[model samples]
Target: MRRSRTGRRAGAALALTALTVPLTVAFSTTASATAASSCYAVRGPYQKQAEKFLGLRVDGRQSASDCRAIRAFQTSHGITPNIGYAGPVTWGVMRVVAQQQAAGHQPNRAHKCPTDRGRIACVDLTRQISWVQDGSKLVYGPVPVRTGRNGYETRTGAKRIYWRHLHHVSTLYHVAMPYSQFFDGGQAFHSISGSVWSAPGSHGCVNMRGKDAKKYWSLLKNGDDVYVYGRKPGT
Candidate 1:
């Protein structure tokens, strides 16, 4: 009877151990999955500035799409290990670039832009701003812009707007180039999202705000002078 009691106790202990081990493993697995699914969220003061720059809603909330956009921008600008998180490095780059643009300093002091000034679109690459002038008189802008990145620099010097498309889509990149006015080969001035101001750059085009782009489309016609001067900052 004593032996049987001992045996029964051992069997119960074994069964309990078997059940507890699986339960512990299961709990650990669940905890790991939850942690993995949770992504880092962007917030604080820089969030507003980043949103404005990226052309996203100025709301201070960071969404999944925001992370994705941030990742895309990081990838384009050659930020390593594009993990889609807006950490210190990302925010620092944006602040520096924005400050440079706000300074409105031109790189080409000697280039007087002495061509057909009757109606011209002048792009100051250093300032990252565009303006429409009618014979030295400013018609529109000093508006913010995003030019091409390092490798695909926007061609500097004199050019002419050869084509105009109100609703143009790029065949190469397949992205929309709204209110596009092609000045250089496969390069144009068009409207892009505010997010564009964040980082990376257009392929070879001058990206303007949506409102500014529409204004340019209305103000300038095809075959107008498009003078691009200065080097884009950090290029």
Candidate 2:
């Protein structure tokens, strides 16, 4: 009876092992695909996000301003548009991204900024902004910025110098662009629109004093990593 019971126990264990093996393989395979898809999304985009990057109505008509807005944003981020920078890859991602707030998702490994070694430079661009000190170093820059309309929210993230215009110009603010260095998402480190002590302003780009902006502009280049944190310029 004891020998029979031992054989039955061994058979039950073997059956359980058979069921688990496929599950483990499936899970790992799925994880690998998800990672691959994410990289392709950021590097290329699908169709939906492309529209948002272009600032167009995903299914609606594309206006002249939409074209201009998209151009300006990309320029600030230091990206020379792709043929037109209007790739289908970007559009698909934007379509999936809701303008309204959703459950928070963490940054994928791709977005982390390099500090010191990885970062040859840093700046906090906002219209009428202030500087942050990490030790004796001025780790944060006082950036003048423009912000979104009623519901648009400026973002904070691991950033890098996307594009650097040695001597650039701006049309919206009716003056030469300050700092003129673009960071993530078409935002830049530039001069503030006006003189002020404190206010919540900007459509979500950094602002600066023309002279100070020029100083900041002199220090950066494309791909030098940094982080853009806190509010849009002056909070």
Candidate 3:
């Protein structure tokens, strides 16, 4: 017998509810606890990139101190295998962070997203950030987000928040998508039970941090304008 989508969602919701702390925090704590005693001495493919990102010496070599710092960052950011390897995923996340820093206080300095529409949610796929703006006033965010992966790139252009389900569950994926606000077709702004920086990106949905998603839920409503622009790095 096959399980129903509703049943699966119900199960996932129950499981999600059992968690005491935020998923990211819980994962970070767990990963830190289980991390290896000594950092891996092997040099990753992007060792120098990761080193520079972490403000360490760019020697292109993985030192013990470098490994510990990188591991700490990996654990905090919910990157898997937190083994201190400065691999592609680690460097990718670092690059996103750099862009985010550069975009601070003026996420729309480029004026890519149309500001004509009042109270619009702007998504910069290139920087992997999202912010809510009311005409010229910045209301919320400029928060980090994970967009769609290669084949499932998030569709760009203007849209509207058509529906919102507070305790939403993905019927197809059978996972808890808390605080979902759908703006474009199946693609919505939702909170996942993991780091927004997790690699390979989402399956078209714009994934947000728990706090950010909840804020979006409160600030946005049906009929609100949504504008998505730029291209994700890998896609």
Candidate 4:
């Protein structure tokens, strides 16, 4: 009777293990599924602003969907560490985009850029935008630009393009400054391979996208008027 009782207890233990194994497997599967769907959840400071810009439901909460959307925008715009956080840098670029869209045909509606100058390149440091205007006529752009940083701010006031180099390399920094059109002392309008949206801006040059720079090269020549105005943010 003692041996039979012991065998029954062992069988009961095995039965319990059999039930526990399926539950453990089920929990592991659920955990894997959750992990697969999980995304960075830290709420960014500019969460609401970024959400609104992306046309997402703006509750200011960070969700997996929001993370994916923000990450995609960052990746496309060349914003670094594209982890989906809606930080200031991200929102800053979005603000530029919004301004660009709103600019429409009247980029100079504010009349900050002098219209009297014929075929002038207008650089608005405040908006971080650049365009070419011929006596109130929009000749080209109003595109986003990256100007000089805080200390090495792009000099303001009216100037003239003094020189041009099709394939210029900076002697000071040794970086490529393509389509360089020198307007001020050591400061020029050039194309950078990197994103114009990247912060802290250029050393002194007015950085532009490849296409925009190329267009400027075609339209502008030496002695053309170049007017820079306003103050860059944080400068």
Candidate 5:
């Protein structure tokens, strides 16, 4: 009788274990499914603003695609970490850009520009835009730009273009830097890969789009003035 009772207890323990295993697995699976579907929420009108700026569908929701687009924008603008989330810092940058666009205000150009310079390349670090001016006349555009990342901050001051290279290669990074124009030390203005528009930043140079860089190469010459001003937001 004692042996029979012990065998019954062992069988009962195995049955209980079998029941608990499936329950635990089901709970874990449910939790994982919930997490996979979880989405980041953008506060206020920033969703619409970012969508418009990125040319994404404005669905008023922070979907995975929206996050990817925001990450691309943040990466291009030198926002750190590139976590693919639209948090406060990301939203703040987007908000300022949206407001500037809405008001038709050219960032970092509200103050008086230098009149003595003949042909100038004005870099607005705040807005990540660059333009060319021939003595107060707008010669080129407010095109998108990618400046230096943290620790390799681009110098913000007056500089003069000292050299021009139509096809240059970086000895340090071993990458192609087309339409290179040296201004301050090793820092230069050049055309980077299209990935820069969806990646981090350059070492200590001002990066421009391919077409803009070509235009710059044609418009600017050696000894021209390159004025870099303002601070990149969320640096």
Candidate 6:
């Protein structure tokens, strides 16, 4: 599922500088020479592998070599000194760079954050569907969702959900999904046991704990800031 996400690059911003540690270089890219398309704007196979294997995916039209070049760029930009140089950190940084460039904030980098204001309220990476928070109150959700495996994760920054759920039952609240995926889509998040960060993992969607599922279901109301997003898109 393609995601509309944005945030200040962790290390690219002052966050890392304040800590006196350089940003970690963790991604390499290979873009096709045909165009200057941004990685975030292009989603391809590497994006799939990056998300699945590294908990982060590549965007834009970068080739494997472009991915590698991205790593070199980060290294030159003082991202991090001689480490992996190509991983989730790179994706996170690129998000910042892409948005910043698009917003005309920086020359080639990004500073603006991304969000799904009109996009889907929730997304199921494995299921490839965005969830409706409260089709009635929120005027957006109350839709369907396929959360993570264990039900213990939801990314931060994409959406800020402040509302709570009553009757706290994902299954009862959003009747669009089945019994299996409905395990507890309430507030819990998703993430596979091992790594690979592939489609199998939580993919940065909201996982739910069975116990808290029904509780949140019975508690959430309208106009809540469902602050979502912690992982990157493609993760």
lDDT tens digits, residue span 1-235, model 5: 3578889999999999999999999999999887654544453356776777778887778777887778776776566545456666667666555644642434335754565688899887766777888877778777777788777878899999998888999999999999999999988889986643433466879998788899999998999999998776646
**Model 1 segments more than 4 A misplaced:** 1-111
The order by descending lDDT is 3, 4, 1, 5, 2, 6
RMSD of each: 11.1, 18.4, 13.2, 10.2, 9.2, 21.4
Candidate 3 matches the true fold with a TM-score of 0.83
lDDT of 4 by residue, 101-200 (tens): 7888788998999999799999989888999999999999888899999899999999999999999999999999999999999999999999988887
The model with the greater lDDT, 1 or 6, is: 1
Q: Which window of 10 residues has the lowest lDDT sum in candidate 2? A: 100-109
**Candidate number with the higher TM-score (3 or 6):** 3
Least accurate stretch of 10 residues (summed lDDT) in model 1? 103-112
Each model's TM-score, in the order given?
0.58, 0.38, 0.83, 0.82, 0.63, 0.21
Report the C-alpha displacement of residue 143, candidate 3, in angstroms: 0.2
Each candidate's lDDT (Cα)? 0.76, 0.47, 0.92, 0.91, 0.75, 0.36
Please give, for residues 1-235, the per-residue lDDT of candidate 6 as tens digits.
6433344464356665755542222112233332333333343433543443333443434455555565455554345421323455555444433432342312112212223333224443322223333322222222223334343344444443444433333344343211122222344332222222222334234533343233335444343334333333433
Which window of ten consecutive residues has the lowest lDDT sum in model 4?
Answer: 32-41
Candidate with the larger TM-score of 2 and 5:
5
Worst 10 residues of 5 by lDDT: 99-108
By TM-score, the best candidate is 3
Candidate 2, 130-177: lDDT as tens digits: 333332344434333334323444456666678876556766655565
**What value does the lDDT take at residue 114 in candidate 3?**
82
